[model samples]
Target chain A: MRYETLREQIIALELGRRERQFIPIGLSAIDDALQGGLDLGAMHEVTGPAAVFFTQMILRQKRGGAFWLATSSPNEEYYPPGMAQYGGQPEEVISVCLPDTKDLLKVAYEVLAANVVGCVLLEVQKPLTQTQMRKLQIAVQNTDSLGLVTRGAHTGTTSPERESACGSAITRWYVTVVDWSHEKTQIELYLVKNRRGSPCRWIVEIDHATYDLHLVSVSGE
Target chain B: MQRMICIWFPFLESERLIRQNHDLATRPFALVMREANRAFVSALSRNAGNMGFAPGMSLADVRAAAPDMLYFDADPMRDIRCLQGLLRWASRFTPRVSRGGGHNLYLDIAGASHLFGGEDVLLEKIETQLEDFGFTTRLALADSKAAAWGFTHFGSTKSNITTERLEGAARELPVEALRLSYASTALCQRLGLKKIGELTKLSRVALTSRLGLDGVCRIDRFFGRTAEVTEFARHKKRLIEEEQFFDPLATNAGVEAALERMLEKLCQRLSGMRQGVRKSQLQLDRVDHETMFFSIQLTRPSIDVNLLKRLFLHHFDQIDVGFGIDRLILVAEQVAPLSCHQLSLENSQTQNREQDLEKLINELSNMVGARYVQRFFPVDSHIPERTFSRVAALYASRLEEWQSPSGTRPLRILKKPVSVLLRDGIEKMAPETVFWHGRKCHLTPLSGPERIEPDWWRDDPDWRSGGRDYWWAKADFGALLWLYRVSDEEKTQWFVHGLGS
Candidate 1:
């Protein structure tokens, strides 16, 4: 009887469901602002004057290892001070960067689809076309991993894609820097789409002293 | 009125404690005002009270009452801090906590009595602790807060009042213990109603007409006729663990050490839940409006704090502690029941080989970028040019492909098959006969043609010249090549797809 049970279990193993998990970002303000932390199996877009700050926050929020792929033009620089500022260690951050955009995307997709990466962060210049975005979206869903794509406006053209790919992503966010001046920086996070509920937005002031982002306010749009 | 047992420790200050002992716990012996300047005798030591001192006496009068009665000011902050500390220690008894107004801890231990072997045992435990702390605690448990308050102030040792039985117990207590305002007390006196029992028997409308809303509320609370909700501040989201540092830690190492401890505490909690975390978010909250967060992701679901801490070490460089981190919070998310691994019966050699291959591929994939790995897949066609497809990475089971049964394929396939001149309806597809370096005359064998139609779906009008016939040819030089004939051309296009090796 035990052997029969064992045999059944072994057979079941080959057809097991994909497991999804989440780690709450310790920032109560952000966690409350985000409703809960970023959903573990979706793409979160961080865009704004300083998307890097929230990206760092999200990266720190996911303590599960992330495969970070940063793409840049030859002359462009990516000297993000927060990578080290938020507990991102040298070894845990796997970077695959190249001068070519397609190669970078190809590499990003390959790494994310390997099923080993817990969360993936890809920093690109412009918004990817609908078709290109769909390919990446499919890759992430197929592998059951969280894929966060960071597209900074300063890098180049910022245009909305025609259509997003299939796969009912858990959540999507658009991080925008609402205000920054006089030694103070405020970030506005817009939840563009969420299948679970209506969209929400939160504004946070980035503390220069501790590099901590504070919840200045929130608005449900 | 749901029961609220608000335990008020009147003489909580150790130095000002009116204890039954001499040299009362070392400092100046005086029951400092509860809200100093509010003129309520918060605490009174035996020495101060014995020297003809009493609560509510003006400080000047108290000074006059006992010239040598050493007086000290009351500190609400310190008292509340001490109260909170005591409450933390008391939390082991129950999860509910309500501390409001000074030195009053309301414990709702109504339903939890039997759990600790009944009310007497629970009260005994509290009493023993209060005694150890040298506090004069007036313990009361009643169905209503006001009645409980009356019992706390007036009941004697034998009262043994439980919340369920407090209504009758409060009848004999003086009306003053009802905590009626001085004005209400005066009105009650004017009406010649001095006992709580007398007030309880009065009509509600009559009570209201006499003292208005305040009177009605007081009577309602006192008679257990109204309900009160005591808001106990709890963590917004459930907290696994929390720690604070007096001095803000500025260095990464200091923060890491603090995080290490938090992880340990978090792991203990997660393990108890019979679960593991897939991700842990670390927040380094600083005092001066600065916060840094580090999120670490685990490859496998785990409850192991050590491994979590180790993973966070990688992103340690990202945290920018502009000022210093005073508080640290680690929240583990994405929890799941840890699946147990069952090792297979497959022996060491096969397992070792698989492990070696996986490691080798992983290393190469990481080095060359994961996109660069590739293997060849058979393209379903007899024509040499359409024979294979390139598949990416270690996803392929193996690179080996079956050779065409009747043909000898080549050492190297041209990226695009090249067309060459033919001699009299026969193709010069043989590498030996078709002089490269001008050497010919080796034993060459050529196979008959296998035809292949154009891929009409992919056919460009300009590129669709026609169908082609393919042949497998061998030369004495040990090279096997694939040659094809375009029907329109008097030449065969030669391409190499594979070697026998």
Candidate 2:
């Protein structure tokens, strides 16, 4: 019933004549999970350890632009390798390493106000407060740029304010590193909340050696 | 004879304004502070002496004279700036006004005296205007800077002197009216030259020898005997252009479009004057008289409309547009004369290349950012990092295109490489096992113990853990990582600095 409504809207708007929106991280399962990639001009929370997936997603080659805010590792030397892992040119990558939460807010708002960067990733350990998140959401929406915040496991801890920061995030995804013993390390991704669509769980295998992710086929039919 | 006018404010008034408060203009206020046994009044408010207050009077004596007077400490430098601002405002009348030695103005109204009717009318107009603005000005007119400076000091109290009677009246005035220093005044007194007419009797060389060069020059200038260098106060150009919006712009696009219109008008004004602007100040006025101002500076003199638009495009989102934007203004400043480039037929090739380079820079800047789009240039330095300085948003060609002197450098230079721990004191000696980030790892193979010295000039002695020696070490499982050891006062410590992957 939902698909019929969406199809009717697309047909009514004559969207078939237009080209497909080619977002780089267009995995079928992830797209369906995200309800058609991250919405333009919105905030998404992708929480994990030293989030390399978020890095790749932001560094994706696009005609527009990409921005990365890495705070987990303060050193600028670590950015090139992560960007190179996704076949993105290191020289072309723009990353801002904000030292603290205050600086993060200042730099993020500036990036949004510029309206240059198509994708923005802010990696922070402690989750932002509701006020901070509210301010950032307004900046992103006003600029028409997609903003992603990466947080650690305790992002949704007992502190309701901390939970509210993630709650204000348009979508939230849990990225947990699963050890496959002899097999390559796999990242088990769980869609915690989908504001636009239904939530689902999926396993994506990551080649630790090559730093690549493969979406696994669920045993259905 | 031609005429000039002088306006004198007693001491430095503007500098002591904050302390003087409302009393600065109305009451007989004096900014008095004692340095030694002598009490000196640094600044005096309007009609201070008229209200029976004099500078250099003892604090006790001043209290006896005007007991209800207010006092303040004076700053000479700030008063000079405020005076300059007023002089700039006055420049609209004439360009020949010169700042006097001590809180006085000297205007060479010689050729341009007829603009404001006669010299008396002009002086009256100036005095009345200044009086309306809460300033007490003592006005005088004469044929020369020295002659005018002389009359205003002495003649203003004696008789009603106008520009018509200045030359004859100047001759009878005391030589002390010339504003000569103590030595010059003493020399004039010793020579029995009590009047301007008596000093005019001496030869140029004789007068110079007796009164010194400055005194001779002033005397010569006032008498029209020699040339006088009258320094005029510079006029700052006020280039203000504004756009009145019918309906306040609420969207970024609307504001940006409005700004573009303003920028075009401002650039046209600049270019029409054969000038290229280095900086432009933009003001966005919203409802209720709130103003948002942002200024942009070009790396070089630029009149290109597209470049200016691109730079301002980033700041459009910052406008509030609260209750809607009512007006926008762009002011051209730091403008310079731009020489037009004559193009040859072959110049088209070069122009096309420049256009391509500009496009590349704009695209890269848009992709990364204006702050991040940088170009590195080689410098005359032995150190690797010091060899280049990042130039933000440069449209020049890549630096590596030109051949450079070869130097040894690391494939991966860390942005602040981590401090490490060494097992033993030896640098070349391989670590059998190393613990890093709470994990123990065995080394399979090792290479390099390159020493890197700390920049002693920049390194803080308190925070200095000492110099580091980096090494490329591989684990048994084929995990290649970079490690470094900090040689400190106690011992060396090794740390897993970075991973090759």
Candidate 3:
């Protein structure tokens, strides 16, 4: 009886570990660097210009719908038609616009805890505190859902310390516009913090027509 | 075989005023209406009536007789609303409650009276309830609605006349109880007929010749010879659960406990009926005789007790206990049939996930607003701003297929276009550099100017600039911007409409 009980506990642990799967970023180099891809059931933060676009690309990899929570600002409105250009289903996206920062955080927690949607993108103007971040992380940890947070690049945080201040996020990234030509725009993505892998950087080219990102160069090479 | 009950509020307007402001309960108050520049009393309080003040008495005469009496302009609309509320409340006794001409209500309580033991018990209960609600009422029951109305207004304060005695009882009342026109009543008095029994002696042809067919019909209706059609109040079956406390609850915990108990009972009832509540109301009756009400609307029908408790607790702190609550009532104002789904073990997880999503939508909608939580659908329009529209997530049935436009679109669009200044002069095609957001940026056009015109059938203010020539360009900062130029009889102007990533 004691042996049987021990075996059952071991099986349950294995099942729990298996539930935390990773969502591939569609780039083979990035996928290999992160040991498959970004972890589901974990919180990730992305900042700098084109953060929303990158987040939309990552969300398109998931199967189910996503909840987008943002403040009710005219400048922050996402164009559904434009989002569709990146392979996002406009009808499957549930958008919530809240004027209050507190309400935005509360709704973000609720959507994460619901664990029904595949992804949740929260755009917050104010920086979240360590406690708020941990609370949200704890909420999403119970389910196979991904929490994506995007903040303004000018939020008064330096690169190194900003990564350390992320209390519960599994990974932190900063993407900035580098240069552009007639057909493609070049962007630099820095993997500032990765819990399970080494930090890295990449220079990528975005095709305007297809909205696809091409891996141009790695940091070491 | 039909039994009807009529409830008459002799001082409806004054009683309604006193119910709202209890200070005027003992005071002599009157409601006045202006007629030909003269203020005539339309309704009087009990004290004012005892002081020999009657309706139609001019305000000047009443003021002279009782100088301290209070009078205000009558609100007929408010009185009608009060009567309508009472009509709904009276449906507890019988389903068929109809509104009388003014200040009176008729209830068809034929077989429903037995539920309250008998007609006498039902009438007593109605009178006591109305009295508790601060209204002075006179009630009468008879074999017909006309007889009931006649007996309530002209007979005793509380009378139950059976079929054998309905004619005898109505005959003793004045001819005015027949509900005839003023001209017909005057003609009856001119013929020396003061009572209904005196008019019954006249032949039908004689009465019709002297008072017209309308007068004869009124008498026939009063005597139960003619059937009178009445428009009953539309009553919908409601699921209500309430608890009355001997000791008023003063703490938030106590109220929450009571609410939890009521929610459990209500959920059980809904489940048994295969229904769920879409909208619900919570009413708290305080010890001070004041009632507090809170309402909650859901995105979909739900019968989950815990979910309902969480939603109701959102408004629990807003309740001011005042002197404590003596009674709690929960009413499901709207309900819909919800069939049970047979879920397999494998599908149960998926079903629960869907339910969780629905709960999340409802919670977020309640927190922010239903309108703020929405999904986008493509509209059949070419205008950049009119390409899509938002519908509340609760109301959206399914994901609509988004028809992608032929050309590339921006990831984000500005709510209002910001004007951009051109560097150097505008070239024949497109500007080589532009000042956007206070920064000079070089632009390389990757696509031509796709001309889009406004819909001619409708006048849209956003498209008031006439037609637009759109261009997709790569800016110096590596950002792809969507630019539009509008040219009319005036000079050409450029604006940055969207940002592409």
Cα lDDT over the full model 1: 0.58
lDDT of candidate 2 over A137-201, digit per residue (tens): 77766554677887633111222123332356767775543333222434456666765565666
RMSD of 1: 31.1
Task: Pick the DockQ winner.
Answer: 3
Q: Against the true structure, whose TM-score is highest?
A: 3
Chain B TM-score for all candidates, comma-separated: 0.46, 0.55, 0.62
Q: Estimate the TM-score of every prediction.
A: 0.34, 0.49, 0.70
lDDT by residue (tens digit), candidate 2, B229-248: 77787666667778887877
The lDDT per prediction is 0.58, 0.60, 0.82
Provide per-model DockQ scores: 0.01, 0.08, 0.44
Q: Is candidate 2 or candidate 3 better by lDDT?
A: 3
Candidate 3 per-residue lDDT, tens place, B1-501, comes to 669999999888988998889999989988999988988898899888988878989989998998888988899998899999999999888889999887999999999999999989889999999999988899999888888999998999889898888767777899889889999999888988999998888888888898898888887787778898989988666799999999999988999999999999999999998899888999999999999888777877889888888888777778999889999999999898885667779788777877777788887776676899998989888888889998998777556788777666777788888888888676546756888666677887767688988999999887888988888776665456788998777577888888755
Which ten-residue region of model 1 chain A has the weakest summed lDDT? A154-163
DockQ of candidate 1 compared with the true complex: 0.01
CAPRI class assigned to model 2: incorrect
Deviation (Å) of B278 in candidate 2: 4.7
What are the candidates' interface root-mean-square deviations?
A: 25.3, 9.4, 3.3
